[model samples]
Target: MSKAITNNQSVDLISDFKEITKMRLAVSVVFSSVAGYFLGAEVIDFVELLLLAVGGYMMVGASNAFNQVIEKDLDVLMDRTKNRPIPSGRMSVKKALFIAFTFTILGLLVLYIINPVTAMFGAISIFLYVSIYTPLKTKTPLSVFVGAFPGAIPFMLGWVAATNDFSIESGTLFMIQFFWQFPHFWALGWWLYNDYKRGGFFMLPTGKRDRGTAIQIILYTIWTIAVSLIPVFGVTGRLYLTPVSGILILILGLGMLYYAYKLYKNRDEISAKKLMFASVSYITLLQIIYVLDKYIRIWI
Candidate 1:
C-alpha cells in the first residue's frame, strides 16, 4: 500500500511539471522561432538552430509558467481557466512557483549561450509578460498592447539571435507581428468577454463590445496587412513579397477584416467567435507564406 502511494505521487509530480511549463504552448512558440530563424539566417547552422529552438522553448515556457502562477487566484474565477492545474488544486502554488523559477533560470541560461543580446531580450520578454502584463490585465485593457511587445519579440528575437544585432530588418519583422496582435487579441476578447469579465479582466480597449472596440480591431487589421506589404513596396531591405504571394496575403487579410466588420455590425457572440477563428488562421498562414516565399526565392 505504501509503495502504491509513492508511485502515484511520482506520477503526479511529473504531470505537474508538464502543466506548469505548458509544454504544448512552448513547442508552438519554438516552432515560430525556428521558422523565423530559417527565414532570416544567411548561413544555417544546424547546431545553432537546435540551440535556438530549445532556448526559445524554455523562455516561452517560463513566461507561461509564471503567468499561471501569478494568475492562480483569478484563474479560479473564469470558467475557461478554472480547470488549469494551479486553480484546480492539482498543483500546489509552492510547487508551481518553484517550477517557474527553475524554467526561467534554465531558459535564460540557454539563451545566454546563444548570445547575450538574445538572452537579454528573452529575459525582458518574460519580465514584461509576467511582471507587467499579468497584473495590468485587471487594471486596464492596454495590457494587450503591453503584451504585444513581448509576443512580437519572439519572431524578431530569432533574427537577433542569428545576426547578433538589431536592425531595421528585425524591426520590420517586429512591426508586422506587433500590429497583427491587436486585432487578434481584441477578437479573442470579444468572444471571451464573459469569461474575462468574471475574472475581472478588461481585455477590450473600450471595456465593452461596442463600436469603439470593433473599430479599433478593423483599424489594426488594416495596419497589420499594410505593414506586411511594406516589403513588397521596397520600404524594408532584402525583404520582398512576390506579387502572387502579396495578393494571396491581401485576400487573407481582407477576410480577417470582413470578420472584424461583422463583429462591429452584429455585435453578437457568433460573429465574435468567427473573427477569433479567422485571426488565428491568418497568423499561422501568414507565417507559412512568408517561409514558403523565402525558399521559393532560393530555388528561383
Candidate 2:
C-alpha cells in the first residue's frame, strides 16, 4: 500500500510540474527556435541544436512559472487559469519561485555556451515577459505589444545562436513573427474577452470586443502577410522564399486574412475562434515553407 501511495504521489508531482511549466507551450516555443536555427545554420550541429532546444524550453518555462507566481491572485478569478498549479494550490509560491530561478540560470548558461548573443536575447525575453508584460496585462491593452517583443524573440534567437550575429536575416525573422502575434493574440483576446475582464485584464486593443478591435486584427493580418513575403525579395540574407513557396505562403496568408475578415464582418466568438485557429495554421505553415524553401534553394 505504501509503495502504491508513493507511486501516485510521484505521478501527481509530475503532473503538477507540467502544469506549472506549461509543457506544451514550451515545446511550441522550442520548435520555432529550432526552425530559426535550421535556417541560420550552414552546417547543422546536432549537439548545439539539442542545447538550443533545452535552453529555449527552460527559458520559456521559467517565464511561464514567473507569470503564474505574479498573477496567482488574478489567475484565481479567471476560469481558464484558475486551475493552474499556483492558483489552485497544487504548488507553493516558494517552490514555484525556486523552479523559476533554477530554470532561468540554467537556461541562460546553456544558451551562453552556444553564443553570447543568443544568451543575451534569451535573458531579455525572460525579463520582458515576466517583468514588463505580465504586470502590464491588467494595466493597459498595450501589454500585447510589449509581450510580442519576447514572444517573437525565439525565432530570431535561434538564428543568433547559429551565427552569433544580429543581421538583416535575423531581423526579418523577428519582424515576421512580431507582426504575426498582433492578429494571433487579438483573436484570442476577442474570444476570451469576458474571461479576461473577470480577471481585470485589458488584453484587447480597444478594451472591448468591438469594431475597433476587429479592424486592428484585419490591419495586422495584412501587415503579417506583407512581411512574410519579404524574403522572396532577396533582401534578407540566408533566408529566401522561392517562387513556389512564395505562392503557397500567399495562399496561407490569404486564408488567415479571410478568417480575420469573417470575424470583422460577424464580430462573434465563433468567427474569433476560427480566426485564432487560422492564425496558428498560418504561422506553422509559413515556417515550414520557409525552412523547406531554404533547403531546396541550397540543394539546387
Candidate 3:
C-alpha cells in the first residue's frame, strides 16, 4: 500500500515536471540543434551528439520553466496555458525556480564540456528568452522579434558545438531559422490573438488580426524562403544544397506562402491555423532535406 502511494506520487511529480518544462517544445528545439550539428560536423561523434541533445533539452527546459514562473499570473488568464504547472498550482514558484536553476547550471556545465562557445550561446539563449523576451510580451508586439533571437540560436549553436567556431555557415543557419520564426509565430499569434490578449500579450505586429498582420506574415514568409535558398549560391562554405534539394525547398516554401496568402485573403481563424501547420511543415521538411542532401553529396 505504501509502495503504491509512493509510485503515484512519483508519477504526479513527473507530470508536473513535464508541464513546467514543456517537454515537447524542448525536444523540438533539441531536434533543430541536432540537425545543425549534422550540417556542421565533419565527422559524427555520437557521445558529443548525446551531450548536445541532453544539454540542449535542459537549457530550453530551464528557459521555459523560468518563463512559466514569471508569467504564472498571466498564464491563468489564458485557456491554453491555465493548466500549466505553475499557473495551475501543480507546482510552486520556489520549486519551479529550483528546477530552473538546476537545469540551467547542469545544461551549461555539460555544454561547456562540449565547448565554451556552445556553453556561451546556451547561456545567452536562456538569458534573452527569460529576461528580455518574456517581459516584453505584455509591453509591445516587438516581443516576437526579441523572442526570435533566442528562438533562432539553437540551429547556430548546434553548428558551433560541432565546429567550436562561428562562421558564415552557422550564420546562414541562424538567419534561415530567424526569419522563419516571424511567419511561424505571427500565424500562431493570429490564431491565438484572443487568448494572448486575455493574457495581456501583444504578440502580433498590428496588435490585432488584420490585413497588416497577414501582409507582414506574407512578407516574412517570402524572406524565409529567400534565405533558405542562399546555400544554393555556393557561398556558405561547408553547407551546400544541391539543385534538387533547392527546388524541393522552393516548392515547400511556396506551399507555406500559398497558405500565408490564403490567410491574408480570409483573415479568419481557420486560415491562420492552416498557415501555422504549413509553417511547421515547411521548417521540418526544410531541415530534413538539408541533412539528407549533406549525406547524399558525401556518398556521391
**Each candidate's lDDT (Cα)?**
0.86, 0.94, 0.95
Residue 76 lDDT, candidate 3, scale 0-100: 99
Q: Compute each candidate's TM-score over C-alphas.
A: 0.94, 0.98, 0.98
**Model 2 agreement with the true structure over 220-299: per-residue lDDT tens digits:** 99999999999898888778888789899999999999999999999999999999999988988888888989898789
Task: List, residue by residue over 1-300, the lDDT tens digit for candidate 3.
Answer: 999999999999999999888998898899999999999999999999999999999999999999999999999999999999888888899999999999999999999999999999999999999999999999999999999999999999999999999999999999999999999999999998899989999999999899999999999999999999999989999989999999999999999999999999999999999999999889888999999999988999
How well is each residue in 1-300 modelled by candidate 1, as lDDT tens digits?
999999999998787777678887687677767777777788998888888998888888788888998888999999988988899999887877777788788888888887898899899999999999989999999999999999898778888888888887778888988999899888889999999999999899999999999999999999999988877776667556788888989999999999999998999889989988898788778778888998898989
Model 1 clash pairs are none
Where model 1 places Cα greater than 4 Å from the true spot, the runs are: 1-15
Candidates, ranked, TM-score: 2, 3, 1
Show where candidate 3 strays beyond 4 Å.
1-3
Flag clash pairs in model 2: none
Misplaced by over 4 Å in model 2 are: none
Name the lDDT of candidate 3.
0.95
Clash count in backbone of candidate 1: 0
lDDT of 1: 0.86
